[model samples]
Target: MRAGRKYFIYDVFTQRPLDGNPLAVVIDSEGLDTAAMQAIAREFNLSETAFVLPPKNPTHKACVRIFTPDYEMPFAGHPTVGTAIALSEMAEGNDLAGIFVLEENIGLVRCAIDKLNNGLFAEFDVPQLPEQLPLSADPEAIGAALGLGPHEIGFENHRVSLWSAGVPYIAVPVADLKAAAKVKLNNDAWVEFSPRKSEFAVASAYVYGRETVDHTSSFHARMIVPGNPSYEDPATGSAAAAFAGAIMRFDQPTDGSHRFWIEQGIEMGRPSRIRLEIDVAGGKLAAARIGGHAVRVAEGVLLA
Candidate 1:
């Protein structure tokens, strides 16, 4: 039998274990090709898995490859948070903090790590700011896909919108937490209406409401990926990144730094909280950041 490579599992976007999104990180993964890495991610069967490879430029920390079971991702929020924490913990002990750069597929991601009493928190500047994409489908159609009616579709001025930072998401604004809880994403209906940008296909659904289960959270949210293996995500950073555009469009925050905590994954029992920070300049999105806490819950040898 071949000796296995080292791997770790982290609970991301929450201080406690078994509460947040679980990410599998394979550390000793230099020689493995894309196909093998995809197979390992499928084996772990989490929302996403990260493989750490040596950085092409020696100054950077490492190269991280993120993947869902079905396909590779250019970038993702939880993986960036989890991987940053994992790398920080590996490089420095619990007492010290770190700031480093990770080479992600989208681009070089700048991440900052802080060691706190609850857990280790890591935040990264989103390489790309959110941009709106044209969505032709009306509110009624979008609501139908999420098992909501016209009345339950929107709250305040918020309505259906499509946005993307790197990955695409259709932000469906619902009435309340009650409406958010009732979401049952229909894959066939979703794919039929999902807006495509450029040459890619399949933009996932991100449902949000003003009312939240946690008083600290600014929004209660849910993300559903619709495809051959359609499933709900516990906490989605990328979706939140895309939703930033929708927030800017409707809320119209002034030119300053703002932070909002988004609570997600409650429907799946793996509750998570993601922190989104945006800097507004001249009434436009200047920069944005996604941050969260992570804890290493398990470690093992990956046997082939």
Candidate 2:
């Protein structure tokens, strides 16, 4: 690695700079090993950092590996969008073909970048959805962790379950935004519900209400997994994806472009938005998708 190689980093899920989840992008990660990648992620101290490599199979697309400050992630949402947009912006003049496949630990993921008059839009696909788990029978313990009583948690037809589009999360419904804003990591209860170790499992928390925010129909969220890397993610695409799975499980809302918006981080003052869409028929999950626009917050060289 050269001493002056440049890297581009962006705060994804938010259009404004430094207001979203900060992602460190290592534009040229050729010879850096696993240990070096982890070290670089630690140096950036962000929730996730992307290391881009030349496609192992040129027939595929861009090869990328993702790492958190503590560990590597097989699949994640914002990194996919942010990295694809970065590559699309970089490959403007080149003869790179259409549909870039980002080969990662999860597998080969196809990404498409849209350069519209509005701005840049990046959309990526999750290979498969995580199996749905039954909602938690013990809402009291879960409720107490979020400083809410059982009644405060909504339980009409919706059940809190572990759903995933990429990574899994305990998806629960909160009756109000007030409760959502007060969420903090409940180490004790989370220990019981989360499958992964305390470090990985309890990654983020979300809360949404039908028609809660502006023009957002029937969904608003706040992500609260923030002790180590980030204070709070303004917008979390992975969590949004998980929430999309949860939404499909509960209310398989009508087809014909069922679009909804997710609002997060307003309580903490970051104020991020995520756009969501899903296709369902006869109570079967069909297609789950999430898209968002990313703006490059900062760019500099990642000194190797």
Candidate 3:
């Protein structure tokens, strides 16, 4: 067991504790091997756990390794936000507002931190521009995997689309919030629809609708990764990042900076809110950003 390793627990995308997705961050993971880190992630049993290490580049604040119980991710949203806030809080004599760069598997991500009335807020520019993938599964197959009827699968011009910013997800637009809330993944169907050897192995289904719990929100969403420790994630930043491609494709927003508020995790009782900002110029996506609040819940040392 590696003794004296510190960690913090944070509820991400929400101001209050235990309301949003929970993240466990090992403050300094310099000596831990990959297997040890994976063991720590499983021990935490959260949707994702982060290991913070000194940056390889002097200009970056830190390098973060994100892990689900099953695999290491190139990047993840909440962990990035939570880790930044945690680091900022730890820095002595630092102003509340500043920019920090973090190195992740995808690339270097720049995060801006601000102290809001609710809590510390962190927002980061998407490290990679979301791109549409040629891969797609049948609507029927997708519906079956999600326990939805074919009729409820898509809405308006939106259909099933595969997109990735850093991580990939199947963006599924449903008819309404009610339909979005009722989603259940059938493991067998999902395996059949998205085979293990296929590209969808790393992809999860992200269902969303225009209707939202908060009137100020632009969309309501839910994500289900069938075999993960947390089958349904309360909030998914990566999915929201990929969703920018879907928005540009279906909504066709005019040239300008557009802000979208997304409500997610209501069905699981862990309601979370995510802010997505997209900048367009010359009818092309110039950049995108994801932001939200996080509150520290607990802190402890890992005996192992």
Candidate 4:
């Protein structure tokens, strides 16, 4: 038998185990190259995977690489939260409250870790703020792709828009939770109309509504990653960060620090809540952060 590497499974964006987005964190990723990491990610078959390596700069904590089942990403939210918490829990000292920098392709991301009563929590400021992209696709066409009609497409002052923080997403607003629940993504139509995020990829659809199952939640959302076999993300922090652009453009929150909880993954049964905090100054987004609770669900050795 070969000496295996250590790995952890964490449910992110929720406090409970098996209720949030699941992540695989490969801790002993010193010599694993890009191809090996991608293969490991495919093996886990989760939304995203994180590989931890020794930092090039000793001042920083580690260099974390993020990979989706399909390809490598510049940055991702759940993986950042999950990896930070996983590393903090592994630290030798009990004092876990502090900030550490994780080097990523996007840039150096500063993550703050805190110890909660139930589980550890982590939050990271988005390396790049949201930027609105041009979308020529008609609203009705967008609706049809999601198995929605024009009548149920949007609510007051909300419309289809394209935005990206690190990853791009098509922000689609629906009438209510009922419309959100009715969404069944047609991958073919989505590929036809969505903007290209890369040579081999297009933007994913982010469906949202004001109605939420949790009373404390400000909105309900679902993330649909467009592929041959279309799939839905239960809780997406990157989508929430991108959605902040749509919220600021429409709702126009007062200038200051604002906190909003978005509930997602209900229809899929893995319910999750993502915390979005935006600092508004002069009627513009000065900064933003994505935060969530992560619980270590399983730990084992990866034979690969």
Candidate 5:
């Protein structure tokens, strides 16, 4: 057995522990392999585990690889935010703070950490949003995977399509909040109609509604993938970015910025808030982005 340091991982996406999605941060994983990383992730058995590595190229930012207990994810939102927050916090008493760049496996992501009177907030640039695609999934098939019928979907301007910011997810639009909260992953239909490989068939279901909770607009969503403790994430930045891209493609008003509030994790009792912005120019999707606040709940070191 290998003896090293250990860290006290905490749940991100919420201000308190055990509220949001839990992530394991193995801060000192210098000599671990893919199998070892997966093994450690399984040992922690959280929704996701992050391993930090030294930067391969100094010209870029630091490198980090994220993994679910069972599989490695090319990109993830909470981990990205949480890992940055963790690194920034660790930089205390050191020389790493303010604005920094992370050389993730996906690419170079720029992040800024600022300490405000209220708390710490992190803003990071996601990979450019992807182009919109046609509704590839059969309605019946998509509905089956989501435990919904065609009637429940907002078929007027929305469609079940594929989108990605860093990783891809099957984007399904529901009629309203009620239908969105009642969503259940249709494994059978998902197995057939989903455009992404089985590994990335994490379905993201959302709906647009009037001001509810504490925001002007409410977006309810759920994400489902196999072998993970949490099938539904409270706040998904990656999916939200893709959703903004899809919105720009299908439902942009003639003028001004398209701004909306995205809500997730409420059904699971962990309510999350995300702000999405998209700009459509000349009837083409021009710019897409998302931003939110991240707070540190706790910290620890990894033992190997």
Candidate 6:
């Protein structure tokens, strides 16, 4: 049997412990296979788990593999941010302020780290710009899937749209926070609404509303994956990455750098705040970045 591997648990996207999304980072995953990694991720039973491996490129710091309880992800936001902070802390006493490239399935992601008053702060540029996918589910079908009426499925110019930065998600805008909170996934309806042959076959529905708990927050969001043990994700950086396109397409922001705060997981009692920044030039999206704080909560060894 292989020797025990060390793993750290982190609460990401929040300053305090137990407030943000929980992540398990397995260090020294050099010898583990894909099946083992997937099992470890399922063992942790969090929204997502990360496996840190040696970088294929000499210049990159590390290659990270992200796995949900069900499947491996090409790229994920919390794992990227949390892994950077964890590695920075592991290299404590060294200069942590700089750019580090993390090799992911999507590509090499450039992450910036800095020492903060609360803890370590990490932000990474979206590996790919959000691309719009053809909408396959209509408002009525989407509403039925989410146990909402057609009227509650969309607000203003915002409607149901499919997008992806690295992973795909169906973005559904609601009229108010109450409407967003009322969403409950009807699995049967969802399967019918988004079939396996559809473009959004493996996508989650990201329901959001303009109203937020925090006045500083621009929106309140919730993500529900049909088969995850945790029915609702506390925080979702990948979804936010794709949301940049929806913001640009609908808000029509002027040419400049714009920042927005998204509040999520309030109902689950693990409130998480995500910082999203978008750069626009001549009314076109130039870049997108996601930033957040992660606090180390626990550390242990995994015996497999």
lDDT of each: 0.90, 0.71, 0.88, 0.91, 0.67, 0.88
Q: 58-146 in candidate 4: lDDT tens per residue? A: 99989999999889998889999999998888888766678999999899999999866566779999889999999999999999999
lDDT of 2 by residue, 15-67 (tens): 77767666878887888889988998898888789999889898876789998
TM-score of each: 0.96, 0.89, 0.96, 0.97, 0.85, 0.95
Q: In candidate 4, which residue ranges exceed 4 Å CA deviation?
A: none
Give the per-residue Cα lDDT of candidate 1 at 13. Answer: 93
Candidate 1 — worst ten consecutive residues by lDDT sum?
Answer: 192-201
- Residue 23, candidate 3: Cα error in Å is 0.2
Between prediction 5 and prediction 6, the one with superior lDDT is 6
- The order of the candidates by TM-score, greatest first, is 4, 1, 3, 6, 2, 5
The residue pairs in collision within model 2 are 208-220, 210-218, 211-218
Higher-scoring candidate on lDDT, 1 or 3: 1
lDDT of 6 by residue, 1-304 (tens): 2768899999999988989999999999998899999988998989899999999998998999999877788899999999998888887577777788999999989999987765778999999999998877778888888889987877779978888998878899998988888899887677665534223245788899898889999989999887523288899999999998899888899999999999998988999989999999988999999999999999999876
* Tens-place lDDT digits, model 3, residues 1-304: 5699999999999998889999999987998889999999988989899999999998899999999876788899999999999898888887667998999999999999998775789999999999988765788788877878988988889989888898778888999877897799886667655524223254688899987888999999999886633288999999999999999999999999999999998999999999999999999899999999999999999886
**Model 5 quality (TM-score):** 0.85
Best-matching candidate per lDDT: 4
Q: How many residue pairs clash in each candidate?
A: 0, 3, 1, 0, 11, 0
Where does candidate 3 have its weakest 10-residue lDDT segment? 193-202
All candidates: CA RMSD in angstroms? 1.8, 2.7, 1.8, 1.3, 3.1, 1.9
* Residue pairs that clash (backbone atoms under 3 angstroms), model 6: none
Q: What is the lDDT of residue 224 in candidate 2?
A: 62
Flag regions of model 3 displaced more than 4 Å.
195-201, 228-230
Candidate 5 Cα misplacement greater than 4 A, ranges:
6-8, 59-61, 94-97, 198-212, 226-230, 253-259, 279-283, 301-304
Candidate 1 structure quality by residue, lDDT tens digits, 1-304: 2348899999999988899899999997889999999999999999899999999999999999998887899999999999998888888445447788999999999999886666788999999999898889877988998899999998999989999999999999988988888998887888787875324448989999989999999999999887665788998888888989998999999999999999999988999999999999999999999999998999999878
